[model samples]
Target: MFEFLLNEEQRKLRDEVRELVAWVPRQLILDMDQDKVTFPKEFLAEAGRRNLMGCRYPRKWGGRGLDWVSTCMVMEEVGVLGYIFACVFGVGAELVCDAIIQHGNDEQKERYVKPLLAGEIFAAECLTEPRGGSDFFGTTSVAEDQGDHFLLNGQKRFIVGAEGADYFLVYARTDPDPKADPRQALTCFIVNRGPGVEVAYLYGLMGCRGGGAGRLVFKDVKVPKANVVGSVGGAYKVFNTMMIPERLGTAAMTIGAAQPAVDVATGYSTRRKAFGQPINQFQGVSFQVAQAVTLLDASRAMIYATARAVDAGEDQNHTRRLISQTKKFVTESCQQAAHHAMQVMGGIGYTNVFPVERIVRDLRLASIWTGTNEVMSMIVAHEWYRAYHQAKTSAPRDFEADALEAESGEKIYE
Candidate 1:
């Protein structure tokens, strides 16, 4: 029934990732969660050694050269490990690599992508400033050109890999023209961490921790002109293009975090007794289980469909619309599924004894990060409205009404 979704090679790849995740001990996961420390670099190095770091990039750059669907599959498995693991891997593999592959020059690619995919170095995207939350263009970071180099000075907060990243794919206001288009005013650069760059402060998160969430302060950091990605005034394009992989990857990870929540809830419900019977025997609990399962399956389907559309090189705007919708729907659904799982498992679900509580905390960030669910809704609404208006002009009433009693125009108000 599902033959059309993933082929033999993809299935094998999924199994391979599952095996890789199996090597991650539950104790280590729990320890990391409790300590709120950095993800074990050794674990990431092992993933690189196994050639599982960049599944979508070309094999020449140390990746598997796989498709978006394959990358999503790997993301889903890593997601099951929890938010920290997903965030750590994602900083290098999805966020940074996509930008470098798209905008970096050949030398830039060799300097960053190869070592990143090989796990020799870590990377992070420095986008969110101290003031700007979801507003990418409102960034206050400035990169002043100094003949051969740019002196960067800014503070970026909520950077996932700030504490450990060897370098950052940083964005700054290069034009500094107040009247200029905000989209054209920004620029991207590859900034190495050195004397002028510092991990300023670490954030204590509610759920998603252990991925080195911190603030990065660039104090007159000198980045060479050769490090400019794409062009001085073309970062908007790079940022927008990177959104595709970012949103799709987040959606896939949502599925991963949600599936295990459903599994744990289901197992517990079937065994735990309530009112002289198993909790699963109760309609209230059973219905919640059914809903959780439905959400998981539906989320998986939407994410893969979006991934396939990306792989097929569908229309950029149309694919973006689908990507936004997938990220919004899947992340929200995963959050809801985790909530339902917690309810089904009763009080114990709220404790660390079960993974459901942690899933709840982890999935909350999925909607907030990558862009808020509200932002996703805005994109979906805008695209849908555009298509709605165009359909009226292009395909207006081409067919006879099937159920209407009168002409469509006649039925409408003046």
Candidate 2:
């Protein structure tokens, strides 16, 4: 509906991504859902071969050097397939690559970033642990410096692509001081899966399966000093940078997943009969479809605006809030849309005979991962109030003055 915001090149990129998505076979999606495939290496390799993995990275690193909007476009199109596909695609293309492109030296880029985008290998991020998932600063994994190398010993949980990942982007506490600031206490590394690295156990998930989601155990793994990303103690900045793509990408892909569910429901209503009339002819059924479509369009529009704001490099604090809003709102809205779609289809939707059930399971995780929606709301509320005090600087718009009792007893305390 708001396609005008996209440029010619961006539209072209969208079409290219659509083609790639269309090329996917039905068996792959079914197998991945059934947990028959650990990782869709062949699919990712094909995407890399087509140069569709990292649309935002520079062309020098096998990416097309596109903008965020373009990248989100890729994410959304790929998302139509499922969450696992877009995730494995982005873990290497953006999440892992962003750290290297922004912090890792050229040598590290050549060794890790280039091949990952090209689909020659796969990469995964290790930030969550047995102790916590969202508590980034409270990391317990420690890497002891050993002059020539660092012995990294820790376990990360719920690492997607862990089973098939050629290497991992791991974060561990490097400082010995227990009181040290979390922002200054840790370091990031590109840890390859070798001798001491183990894919401890794969999870049995209800949805978003197949991409080798599992636990990782790193025991006395010798990581060369050269594998450090950014500075030794500046991983906080790297972690912050990685979150932008994480939330924004998740929000964008969710739009793709939800749209198809709505389509299936709407289409089914037209053919399915009730009392000699099409089911959609009933207000109850049509209204649900309307609400689902509205939620989807709204989600897409928010993503478009937020992606543009990010590309323009708006105020860092404001951009952060907007990204959080995008993630929280879009994920929730899309999940609701899928739920509505399921409702519209009645008995059929609840069964495997239709794809809506599968999509519902995949969309269920959107609000929980990439920072929970609860966490997102906290950021939004905090940012809004922090910016609230700035309103006093302007004397013209005295909203309180418009009230019947202008003074209002000065709010009793202020």
Candidate 3:
């Protein structure tokens, strides 16, 4: 029944994307990382030609105007190939394209969104600062009003695609009113990384090396007032709205990466001999594979359900909680799945010669980035509390009547 949700059209899209990624040549991914390559502009151009760059955006802006399911399918396929490609497209589609489609002005949309969709330019988000990543409300980035423009000054670390990004959706504090809520104090701006902005590469990360995550410094960068995204002091709303798709997209990627690891490990177990028999014949190995599949499938279902909710625009709070839970589950499952894949393959799995080793390293970062699993747990718990309280308050009340009947020694029946 769940499989039925994917129609013929969706299935075709998935298969086509899978084939495209399959021909990417594994050595290319390795070579990109080895050389510290800039964002693969040519590869992105090919993706644009395929219409994969704007899978969920409206067709008016050079997009295909497909549903969220199609977007998830495309992400899953890219993720299976490698996290580098997945991260690039994720930032492009979710953070960049979605923002422009939802909030950018007519001029802003034409200049940024159109080119982004056409793969002529790449975009990045500048939210996480050195001191205020998990606690975004405590950001120190300040923007001073200069009449017709604003002066942005601060540093952002761990900015993905910084080296090649044509523009950035940067968050800065515009209101310094001590009484103002932190959420209301900040503003979002579309800043071109030139003049006063400096991008420095962060070398030697654990994985996802192909996608450049760097430190971005802003020294009184002049941003036009017109560059503001949405309304001034409305960044918190934008951030909250964006999280749903971001987390759901991440979950899709986790499923994609994990599934391949499971398949690789299972195939190896069946073919490799141990004690004069197939390793897969051993109950221990088989059980591990079973556990991996079970977790992966469960995570996939959770992710899909969350994505469906987002598409329908129903129960946003519930969707956010589910997205957080799904991201944590899927990312942790993928990491474990990658570990199992390597364990089953023994020495061969650890060598650079094998893809699993690289995948395992890449998956390790998933648990760290995209609001670390620890943060996801906190978000889920907080939402659960809020939901519980809302339910308690809205629940039908017959407490007085029930108490009186019980006190009078009368039976209370449902």
Candidate 4:
């Protein structure tokens, strides 16, 4: 049996973030999107002053030195507000600042991580290409070394914050050894967006329209030799490390998005009268709300548990498996919850006037991006099978008294 819980600090952080973000009117998000806005530098600078931009990294690198769980809570609150503030600070700080802290040299860290933490600059993680998304190892982006610098030539698609990004953590193939492992062939470079680098906006997205995502075309864009992150051909490891946090953060985002829909539906059902009674008094609608709440709570538990494991420096393989399962479960559950929410809201949910419609569209992208739900399911199945096989020979043991008590209380079984 399992339980979903949040500590005092996490609760406080969530409250604070929610209070701060509440000041940002929803119409501002629509306005920003309509204006084709670049990053909101002023708002980000305010966030920087509050230390929100550096929530997960070490204090030495201008971060808050918090654990991954705290970071997840912060991300969830931001996601609840919408993608505008979250996208600006989340991608800039988590993906890029953390990458530099982990792999950048002293000079690189000082140049990129510090300023980014101060919200003086924006960064983008460029992994997806026009030719590949999940198949990042098959990237056709190439970077050629020329003594003092590397010339990058390729096109990246679906790059978040590309239009406003001052720096890009670009992944490219530096070695073309056909016999070498595909994953090992890929390398990463921190290239400034300058001459020969073109950024094109990806307008009219189905959802997450507040976030700036676009295509980047690099035509022999020159990068200094010192700008390489980690080892020359070590992108696989970097990618793996980066994804752990990314998936965990995504889970939090889904929970944030879904919870609102669930709340709205619950409120509507309890008040809207049908057949001379509140709609929620009906079994069908009540059951749907119950199921949605259960799934959301369960998903939050898995996500927090996985984040805690990573922060504790537990086994990487186990953590990755947990992360994959959490992402798959949460994203799928969110979509289902959104659908039920719409169903409960009836005709009102179908209109743009209600937020449930937008939430449904937003949650759809969660399943598709950051590795598809199909891919996550395959990974989860593989890991479960491996673990089962490895432990199958052991004898079974009796459950503890607490386990029995919890199980008998109708809690979900592990």
Best by lDDT: 2
The clash tally of candidate 1 reads: 0
- In candidate 2, stretches whose alpha carbon ends up further than 4 angstroms from where it belongs are 408-410
lDDT of 1 by residue, 327-352 (tens): 99999999999999999988999998
Q: Give the better candidate number (1 or 2) by TM-score.
A: 2
Q: Local distance difference test, per candidate?
A: 0.86, 0.91, 0.81, 0.79
TM-score of 3: 0.92
Q: Model 3 segments beyond 4 Å from truth?
A: 1-3, 393-414
For 215-236, candidate 2 gives per-residue lDDT tens digits of 9999999999999999898889
- For TM-score, candidate 1 versus 3, the one ahead is 1
lDDT of 1 at 390: 70
lDDT per residue (tens digit) for residues 1-414 in model 4:
121356676676667776767766666666655645645666666667666776777777787777888887887777776544565667778877777788778898889988888877878889888777988788899998888999899999987788778889999999977678877888888989799889865757777765568899999898988898998898887888888766777777778777789899999998999899999999999999998888887877887888888889987667778889998888888789888899999999988777888778777788877788788888888888887777766738533444646557666558
Q: Global lDDT for candidate 1?
A: 0.86
Provide the lowest-lDDT 10-residue window in model 3. 398-407
Model 2 clash pairs are none
Per-candidate TM equals: 0.95, 0.98, 0.92, 0.90
Highest TM-score scorer: 2
How far in Å is the alpha carbon of 120 misplaced in model 1?
A: 1.1
| Model 4 C-alpha lDDT versus the unseen true structure | 0.79
Note the residue pairs that clash in candidate 3. Answer: none
